[model samples]
Target: MDEETFNISMRKFLKKVGVTSQQEIEKAIRAGLANGRLKGDEKLPAKMVLTIGGVDLTFAV
Candidate 1:
């Protein structure tokens, strides 16, 4: 892929995933806070798993 095309594609992909993931995380956090499961100032450990075909990746949040 050419530089311009690659940049555009990556930016599009990142924007979509980043926005969706952030919204979902915020919703979950709100639910936890409402149910007394989170104290609002806790450093909680979080994990995310992403798989694409035969490749898998793990991330900490």
Candidate 2:
């Protein structure tokens, strides 16, 4: 995913999960990684999920 879309989707998910800051998201992601819930080389959720603020660039031309 592009940097802008990744960040925007991350912020939205964080807010939905009750995280309000970058620190919180970072901490959560790190924890997930350590626990094997996330992977060291895997991409972020948005990259797989698709769409940001209703925009889906997967089909963009």
Candidate 3:
């Protein structure tokens, strides 16, 4: 595989994931607040799981 091509693709994928995830999270937070499910000062727990072929990783954010 070409290293430059692989790096570019990986960066694009990560950027898309980051932007979309942020938008969804913001929308969820707004909905929760509107419905009295979440207050404005709560520490929220978030997790992310990534799987690629035989590799799996989990991260807590």
TM-score of each: 0.67, 0.36, 0.83
- lDDT for 29 in candidate 3 is 99
- Give the worst 10-residue stretch by lDDT in candidate 2: 45-54
**lDDT value, candidate 2, whole model:** 0.69
Report the lDDT tens digits of candidate 2 across residue range 13-43: 8677554455677888899999999878777
lDDT tens string, model 1, 1-61?
6999999998998799889988999999999999999999988776766545556654544
> Tens digits of per-residue lDDT for model 3 on 32-61?
999999989999988876656556654544
Where model 3 places Cα greater than 4 Å from the true spot, the runs are 54-61
Better of 2 and 3 by TM-score: 3
Rank ordering of all candidates by lDDT, starting from the highest: 3, 1, 2
Query: What's the CA RMSD for each of the models?
Result: 2.8, 10.3, 1.9
Best model number under lDDT = 3
Candidate 1 lDDT score at position 41: 97
TM-score of 3: 0.83
Question: Deviation in angstroms for 51 in model 3?
Answer: 1.5
